[model samples]
Target: MELLQPGESQATRLHTPKGDVEGVVTCVTPWHFRISVPEDKAALAATWLRDLSDGYVAFDPDPLRRLPGPIVVSDSEAQPVTQATGVPESHLKPYYIGIGSTTDLEPLPAFTWEEREPEQLRRTPLFETHRQMGAKMIPFAGWEMPVWYTSVTEEHLATRQAAGLFDVAHMGVYQAEGPDAGVFLDSVCGNDISALAVGESCYTHFLDPDANVIDDTIVYRRDQDKYLIVVNAANDDKDWAWLNAVRDGKVRIDSQRPWARAFGRRVILRNLRDPKEGPDMRVDIALQGPKSRDILLALGCDAETRKRVLALKRTELCEATIGGFDLVVSRTGYTGEKMAFELFVHPERAVDLWNALLKVGEPMGLKPCGLGARDSLRTEAGLPLYGHELAGPFNLGVGEAGFGSFVKTYKPWFIGREAFLAREKQRQTVVVRFRFTEKGVRMAHLGDPVLDRKGRTIGFVTSCAIDSEGFLTGQAWVDLKYAEEGTPLYIFQGKPQSLGKSPAELKTGDRLLLPTPAVVLSRFPR
Candidate 1:
């Protein structure tokens, strides 16, 4: 084989099952090289690359002089190669080309030429209020949000027993409006957007073409031509980009699920959290628990608005002025409470609304909650979190997360519909909620392995938390055969610090680090 230096320009022909295809080498490294193909031949080149296993490519520095032996290339590490090759960055577009076997290559230690300064954490509109209340703040999804005021357990039980107020302004709020709004949403979301009447909302997921969940969201139909989408804080920017890509016709949908007629120009999306969008900008605050209705009633609102709030049901919303603030009130929340409500208000009014709710509801056992309690409550409620149950290293979809009912498979066409259906037909694993039957065990963590009776690894824990009942409650993705309710399992908790030496070094360390006994339940005992 001939050796080529970095940035060496050479005409190359790749031999594949299809035929020999020509391209120009744009960049080269010790392990990989990128090829630039003509735009018209892009599809043919892709097909050639996909068909090759152990292929050969001939390089000709000059048309008259070809290399003595063709370079043997094997497809490995399909991910983009970011290693620093001596070659200067090229302006020409390049296609993915894998070369040489990487099986024997040792993994490179992570290093960076320049240290990047840490990004400053963001603060919500009610940051000052939380500080004044002596809440313990921590970094969460790029925001310095409160984790708890008094204690996580205290705030958690308060929400379940009476009421708890939460500052959820960091969540992403978006609006889609125009003639084909519902049609466009129906094409992108897994749920049946057309089924939602004005003033109704439903939980759904944004799925990629492979059926992996992009993020789970709540879509509220605020008007005939407008809808509100609430997404997770960590996925706000990604969700925004994905929505725009669909709107601009940049993303491809399956032929079976064709795009809506005039989808590109018929709908307009707005980031409701953008202050530049004017006074209409919105953020979220939640009032959840059994006494949420009584606290909302005690607020200073007109008799008509109070009656409307009282009449609201789960998954229903209404535009109302409460406590002299104009906002949209929704009977929805992450916590599993029948009387919970999430209020969407302008950023300037968030602090006032929070204070107002506290003043009126504090007498009714309403406690200011934070992210810690929020997570614990959701875990106990068997709700799915984005990076945990829905999608992560496991690439779990709605079906695996036990929320497949929310996905309207009956719809003839939607993004990922075909792939999701195929996945469900072949699925062998499922996520199940479980609780530790005993106490004094370390909290289960993400990626902790789950084991069966004979010590066979079955699955891994997705999310876990200490619930209001002081028991460790968690969700795990286990093999389908082991997902039956009341199934016995064990969570392999890693070695505690007291065990001292590494398990490989200590004679008894492996025996000392024991798996916590757990039982799969139909759901957390709500």
Candidate 2:
């Protein structure tokens, strides 16, 4: 019931299922628990508790098993399984149990932040391409995704110094067009879609009633009264569902298939694996970095084409042909670097386009990058990660600084509009930093409290990490009282134990708690 590290404790129960059973409690992230019954009766507990829904209980002499029963216990209460009646704390290994609601435990003076994994969990249109490039695949937003191809540092540095590529096709693309497109968007999203000029894009969020962030997305004005909403992959279903439920416009909502040909045979297919394949969609490649413009110019394109393509001042849409494939090029990159553009080409010519771009940028050290590098680069840039940074049921105007200001006042209204606006006045904004420790361990995740130099209760450490340079970094949304610049804070490596009197005082440096850098704000912007 408590978010504590793995440990053992003794408990006395009024009624004993297995007489005088003593067990131990183990700690995991967030709040989850598992109970170990004695091995002699573990099988009985498993079968007897199998159908119980309150919680899962299981026993495995050799392996762990989940049994039936919702074992309800509190932070102060201890439930134990004894060596005679059940397994000892050392004998019973801990495993994933289940999620606990806010009401289930004592509401900490703070709350833990979590993001929704991507939905559909399907491979991107370029799944095979990522695999072919040897991407380290993992589950993100429900999809098997590339975390990184090489080291996050190498790839991150590559994107900064040269150019790199990413399979961003996992990003969801929704098309809204027609007379009411702008109006429909205004009513569904948390921004004013009406002011979007042609060829321009804006960042916005969708929220729930409690003002928790649902998702953050880029809304591009494709044309007059037409918009393309590029959203986080994990929020695809939620975004679409919220839009569909709230949309009052005659505007059509379409999840456009990647690489669809304008003139090719048209057919609707559930998945790309279908044997009856039509002309595949275009391949999108991002050419980015300071020398990106020069590299494109050297690729043999005409001066006008290069200007239209290389110009990074603003996003431009241009038509060109690459490797015999028609292209729709956009001058945009994620790293906030120099001239860059994502090329949209025919799927049939994807490999050719990728190879050509690689060949052109190779001299400049342009490496074929992966997701790990992209994450670090963007994180350092203070760019929001779809799931980690933005997903929520929180309000916009009041939650984060500068976040609500840039948001268009009017938006496609979502779950939290009224309630968010109402509570915006009382909310305190704090930023989370992932700082590193002396051991070179990079911090990650949230809910770690922040302590001042005196060990006074100033704030909590929300997130922490060690970057490529061995610099420890972290971010947290702390009390507005302690959020001021130059406020000294310490991040603890171990969990905070409430000795029922006061918090334990430990040396900051030894516990991985160090003074936050002077440049913390630059890396984690409001």
Candidate 3:
């Protein structure tokens, strides 16, 4: 029941006859407050607020006051009123009135809600555009993202043969600046950050002290003391916390890494995705394929800019103006394409750039791709996804995923360097890519057992997908003995649909379904 002062916000909950509603309450003005609740439960919440307050609260319906979710505005000065004039029944305003102050209330019991509402899914800047294009959307990494515009196979094939555009704006963008930025990064990142020259970028992993893969990221050296980091969308919050912890010296570092021991070094971390950061705000858009360079050139940059962009090699980036929007253009991508480019542009211009790219590149077979094609493309390219090949249930690191060369072992220090080396020497399992020899089989799923010809379990599938060539390609973590190239293996798929036996009736070693044959490849045939 404690009132928040103007410009203050607090996490609070309200007790209603129906149940308990939890959300944040902010005091926008001395006499006005705003209550924010889940968008899906807004109507019910409004009714509960009215009932609890005994008609003393009045809802404000000002258009300018509306936010992304349902917002309830209440005028504290208008309290003790029996009725509110001009209030619509269908569009009731939300406001809460506490009967007493927090100090006067009895303590409440801690109880979990049986039916918890799902957290609202966020939308990218191009969400409306995707809907207009009839793209099928699904929830991915807490965002409502397009799964595919057309069939996954068609989009996948177009990218490999021509070019594909992706709205990777959902990915996280962060900035590290100041004299000690490189030193701070080098102390935490597995790869050596100080070695990167201006305009150069490198693939690296953020490692915990125990050598676990926190996240895989790409660090771009934008200037002498400024660097940009792009991380997996799902790990954005976690990665930010981890980076701050290291910067603030909250996380311990080994004495061997003397550079990291300087806890109070002047380093500034900024979330580039946050608009409050002003000019540093950016979102990612990727153009990847064989003709990706051509598509970029067609965006109408001037002679000098075009020359610089064309000269950019792999892992190189430059600030350039294209189509009247300034962007950080990098010759880097998740897809294993030599000519790929990832453009970092202001969020306000993301939609304009996306439309411009599609318009100019469409004649050359450039298609707007979605998450499905992106996954399949990366899978075929043998790139590691964070949850599958790197961490998650498998708990594999960069070394286990066959990218140990990316780790700078000679750096003398890094958060997990020692642990990584120790684990690499004692590794008993490795992740490998494989291709199904035959067609007409279900895609292998995570945790599906990989078996040898003798029906002995040798490994488990981490990820799988249908390639453009009509073959099931996948990555798996298997015993070291079966990690060689061209090793024949079989995946034990679950029981077929036609099987009459229940799952509980299936006995060990009984064949419920035929095993799919596959061959371990040294690398996927991209």
Candidate 3's error at 486, in angstroms? 1.1
TM-score of each: 0.74, 0.62, 0.74
Local distance difference test values of all predictions, in order: 0.78, 0.52, 0.78
Stretches of model 1 off by over 4 angstroms after superposition: 1-118, 255-265, 495-511, 524-526
lDDT of 2: 0.52
Q: Model 3: how far is 282 from its true place, Å? A: 0.6
Q: Which of the two, 1 or 2, has more TM-score? A: 1
* Candidate numbers sorted by TM-score from highest down: 1, 3, 2
Model 2 Cα shift for residue 373 (angstroms): 1.5
On residues 169-260, what C-alpha lDDT tens digit does candidate 2 reach at each position?
65665666555566545544566556666766666676544556667776666566556666666666666655553342112121121111
lDDT of 1 by residue, 1-526 (tens): 0134566655665544455566666446533576665555557676555433223332222222112112344433333323323342221111112222223222222111232333898899999999999999999877899999998899999999999999999999999987568867877898988789899999999887678788899999999889999999888878888888776655544433232222323578999999887987999999999999899878878888888888888999999988788989999999988889999999999999999999999999999999999999999999999989988889888999998889887554567876888999999899999988897778888898899988899999999888877999899999999988999999886523453456668674344556889999885454
Clashes by residue pair, model 1:
none
Score residue 353 of candidate 2 by CA lDDT: 69
